[model samples]
Structures are given as C-alpha cells and as structure tokens.
Target: MRRNGNSDRLSPIRVYEWMPVEALNTLLKQLEKEKRSLENQVKYSALRLEQESKDYHKTSRERCTYLAERSQVSGSYQVSKRQQMDQLPRMKENLVKTGRCNSVNQKTMNAMRGPVKKISRSNHLPKLNL
Candidate 1:
C-alpha cells in the first residue's frame, strides 16, 4: 500500500514544495512584477508606433505644402519672364529710334559745319579771285 501523499507521481520535485508560505508569496509577487514590466514595455512600443505615424503624416503634409509653394513661385517667375520677353521687342524698337535720332543730329551738325567752313574760306579769298 502507498503511503498517503507519497505516491511516485505526487511527490514534490523541488525544494519549493517545502518552502514557507512567505517565500511562495514572494515568488508570486516577482511574477506579477515581471508581468507588469512586460505590459509596460508593450504599452511604450504601441505609443511609439502611434507617435511615429503622426510624425510621418505631419512631415508628408509639410512636404506637400513646400512643393505647392515652390510650384506657385515657379509659375509666377515664368509668367513674369514671359511678360518681360513680350515687352522686349518694344524696348528694342525704342532704343533703335533713340539711336537713329542721335545719328541724325550728328549728321546735321556735320553738314552745318561744312557750309560754314566753305563760306569762311570764300570770304578769306581775294575779292577778284574766281
């Protein structure tokens, strides 16, 4: 006959079986502490993921805004350049007219000087000399 609580399968495997109740309580507390630590780590990881997602979205929005602004600036620059190009021919025509006026004035001055010189030379010649 097997002794009570002494069966081969029912026998204690480790010394904890003979440990005080306080020691078991301490072990239970340690397991709870480890469980809480694991839970906190999971929470922190989840929060980090959420924060990263938000940051990514914000950065994407900022990038889109920057691109839009750049496009607008480029468009304005192109329009202004086109306007300037369109006005260039008129500006060139005005410049040509001013140059022509200056040339005409120079020619008039040269022609006036030639006649005055001729008259002065004629006056200085002998009265009877042809």
Candidate 2:
C-alpha cells in the first residue's frame, strides 16, 4: 500500500525500542482475565435471550388460541343474529294473518280484573247547616 501524506501525522512517535518482559507478562494476564469475563457475560446474555424467545413463543400460542376462541364465539353470535333477522318478517306476517294484536288480550285482562268499589263521602260526614 502507498503511504498517504497524512500517515506521518497519524503515526505515534517512538519513545522506547522494546517493552520489559515483566510488564508484558502482567499485560497478558490482564488481557486473559478480561477475555474470561467477557466470555462469561456473553454466555449469560445468550441464556437470557433463549429464555425470552421461549416465553415469546409460549405467549404467542396462548394469544392465538384466545383469538381463535373469540372469533368462534363471535361467529356463533352472528349466526344467531342472522337467524333472528330472518324469522322477524315471518313472525310479523303470522301476527297480521292471525289478527292477534287486536286488543283482545287487554279486554281479557280487564274482564279478569272485574270492577273496583267506590268510596262514599256521606257515610263519614253528616250534613250540617251554618
């Protein structure tokens, strides 16, 4: 690769030629510890994701079942409503042909109830002249 003119500006200036072995060993140990911690964190995150996926699937199934049951109930209600609508005209026609709405029930109810007695005002108070 050809060096760009800006590479000189980005490059770090060398202060020392080599690093000490003790310092290098300590740095390696720190990197190893960091690697182990990062690996543990990744494993924990993976398990959490798996649990969440399972819960999502279970909840999805339950929701689908609930929706299906709701649809079935609504469908039955709609069918019953349609049947009632279909029967309404026939019921009205029957009522008209039979002449059943001609106030006969009211007359019968009045006959069954008979008559009520009237109260007399002359029995309680006598005639007085002023």
Candidate 3:
C-alpha cells in the first residue's frame, strides 16, 4: 500500500498502529460511563417496579377492608329490617287494643259530663201575665 495520507484506505493493522494512546483511553472511559449509566437505569427500573407492586397490594388490602366493613354494616341493617318486619303484626295489634281502650275512656268522659239537654230562657224567668 502506498503512503497516501488518507485514513479511510489504511489497513486494519496500520490503523491499530496509527491510533493514539490518548484516543484509546478516551474511548475506554466513554464505554465505562455508558456501562455505569445502563446499570443505574436497570436499578431504577427495578425499584420503580417494586414500588408499584407495593402500592397495588396496599390498595387491594384497603379495598378488601372496605368491602368487609360495608358488608357488615349492610348485614346489620338487614337484621334490623327483619326484626322490624317481624314486629309489625304485634305493633298493629297493640294499636287496635289502644283504640278499643280509647273508646271506653271516651264513654266514661261523656258520662262524667252528664247527659246534654236543651234549656230555654223562659225556664230561668218567672212566669208573669200582663
């Protein structure tokens, strides 16, 4: 090969010999920097995934607790409703008995007041013939 000062035409062996020590050192430093950057990215991705998993589990637990509490409250409400329904007939019977007692009380009150009669004004005045 002729010594043409063009770098593109240099043979592999000549290129290796021609590369400066400083250039090789800079390339190695850049490769190490890139490797460290890749490692940090992988570590960050792993931490993020772990955090997401924890959040998901926490929300799932909260959802379960909320559902359990809601079910308990609804169950109590249903039991109270059933108890009210069961007592409906008794309540109606008590009302009917009270109505009958009220009729008797009203008769006694009227009896105490005495029988009502119509009175005329002439009955209070003495009879005088003109």
Please report the candidate that would top lDDT against the real structure: 3
lDDT for model 3 comes to: 0.83
**lDDT score, candidate 2, position 40:** 100
lDDT of 2 by residue, 1-130 (tens): 7788786655552222266778778878999999999999999999999999999999999999999999999999999999999999889778767967535454445466664345688889976999
Off by over 4 Å in 2: 1-17, 97-130
lDDT of 3 by residue, 33-117 (tens): 9999999999999999999999999999999999999999999999999999999888877876786434544544557676445
Worst lDDT window (10 residues) for model 2?
8-17
Superior candidate under TM-score, 1 versus 2: 2
| TM-score of candidate 3 against the unseen true structure | 0.57
**What TM-scores do the predictions have?**
0.56, 0.58, 0.57
Relative to the true structure, candidate 2 reaches a TM of: 0.58
Instruction: Please list the residue runs of candidate 1 whose C-alpha ends up more than 4 Å from where it truly belongs after superposition.
Output: 1-23, 100-130
Query: Which pairs in model 3 have colliding backbones?
Result: none
